[model samples]
Target chain A: NAGVTQTPKFRILKIGQSMTLQCAQDMNHNYMYWYRQDPGMGLKLIYYSVGAGITDKGEVPNGYNVSRSTTEDFPLRLELAAPSQTSVYFCASSYSGQFSYNEQFFGPGTRLTVL
Target chain B: AQTVTQSQPEMSVQEAETVTLSCTYDTSENNYYLFWYKQPPSRQMILVIRQEAYKQQNATENRFSVNFQKAAKSFSLKISDSQLGDTAMYFCAFMTRHTPLVFGKGTRLSVIA
Candidate 1:
């Protein structure tokens, strides 16, 4: 199965512009997450969904929004993009918190540059 | 709150040699999970190994193994006979039942031939 997939492997946005980073998982995972990794740094969570229709803010959720309308899709929206939002974004899925699950499979990631 | 720390920012090893990546975490939860993920140049996050806090024995996956020290809050990954393909950024992550998974800054490992 394509564990998880993210669209737009690369993107460049102007300040005040907006875009959506699409993510999907075919594994029917109950948990999906959005994370951003700046150059030479670890990833910080932006948002997450335990299940469809249940989304929550993560460590760094400013300037972004998310929705999990279906089990397979969790898309992140960037509004009024700023240079600070320049980073590599990742989408991951897992069977987390259910019956002792192990790992979270991730997508290749989307590299965003805001100018 | 839980925090994962990878002290070594970068490390290198000769081909066929062994290397260890150190990780430490802080958490009050007694039962939780720890994970090590490898991100190659392709930017794919690959799960290398994982450990459960309740388990006394460390977890091993083929050439990759973890030295889990629950008392010290340490979870180190040891790669045996490092190969060129093993070169990647390794991140240590922590998660408890109540909180979101937190990740360390990561240690860059270079396996040189």
Candidate 2:
């Protein structure tokens, strides 16, 4: 399996511009997540989906949106980008079941720079 | 709320030596999971090891192991017979049922030959 894959490995956006970071998983995982990592900081969750059509906010969801219309794709949208949004974004997925300890598979991550 | 903390920002060790990276977390949930992820210069998040809070015995994966202290809320990773390939930024993470994983500021580890 390709596991999890993210598109646009590197991107630069002007202030007020918009773009979408695409994430896809071939493992058919029921849980998918979006996270952003700043320099010298831990990753903070932006949004997540338990399943298709069920999306929720996370710790730092401002200036971003997500849609999980299918099990394999969970795309993140950046609307009106700001410099504060400059960071490395990661996509991860995990198999959902009665247990909670399943390991999450992560993508290589996309580096975004907003000017 | 759940939070993971890695106290060490950077550490180095000679090849074939042993090194331990400390981690502590805050959570009220009794049952959860802890993980150590390694990110190299390539920027890929690799799962190194994992531990279940309810398991009394520690988890080991080849040269890597974890010391899980449920009562102390501490989960530290120990690397035995370290190699230069082990150089990476290590992250400690925590997760409860039905919640997003919480990550700590990564500890940069350099294995010198």
Candidate 3:
């Protein structure tokens, strides 16, 4: 069903470069999120959107931006990629904010290396 | 801020044996949710199991089960009759309906023959 799809499975960017990680979900979920996974650190939330046009900052939001223009799409932007920004980025979606229905369906992560 | 911890960086077990992955979390909210997510080499995060704070009974899914201790703030995952395909990175996450999840460093499990 292509629950969640992320574009550019892998990318390499020079310092100061800009790029966008595209994420789309066909499930029409209300909650969408962006998280980055480092070597030993677990996935850290970057940004989240409850619905279209409503976005909020997460635990780690520096050097990144996000937009939820439609229920099916949530894209994360890297304005000035830095070496510290190198990590595997994942996009996820859930039915709602309720804990009972909180299981998130994640997309195939996008591995980005900032050099 | 809430935090989840997986003390074990890695663990190994023989096929058909049972293994337990330890996890502990810190949170002030009494109402929240805990989850175990499995990430294979492919890096896709899949939900293995979930538990609610109010529920005292453990949650079980197939060969996977959880030991949720509210007072101790501990949640451990137990896999019975583990198979070769069970090898993966397991992450413990905490979340409330009002906020996003706080994930642990993760424990890499290797099931060998």
Instruction: Write one digit per residue (lDDT tens) for candidate 3, span B1-113.
Output: 88898999999999999999999999889999999999999898999999999999999999999999999999999999999999999999999867788899999999999
| Better candidate by DockQ, 1 or 3 | 3
**lDDT per residue as tens, model 2, B1-113:** 78788989999999999999999999998888899999999999999999988899999999999999888999999999999999999999988875678999999999999
User: Judged by DockQ relative to the true structure, which candidate is superior, 1 or 2?
Assistant: 2
Q: Which stretches of candidate 1 lie over 4 Å from their true place?
A: A98-100
Question: How would you encode candidate 1's per-residue C-alpha lDDT over A15-39 as one tens digit per residue?
Answer: 9999999999999899999999999
TM-score of each: 0.97, 0.98, 0.98
Q: Alpha-carbon error at A77 in model 2, in Å?
A: 0.4
Candidate 3 CAPRI grade: medium
Q: Which runs in model 3 stand beyond 4 Å of their true positions?
A: A98-101
TM-score for chain B considered on its own, for each of the candidates: 0.99, 0.98, 0.98
Model 1: colliding residue pairs: none
Give the per-residue Cα lDDT of candidate 2 at A108. 92
The DockQ score of candidate 1 comes to 0.61
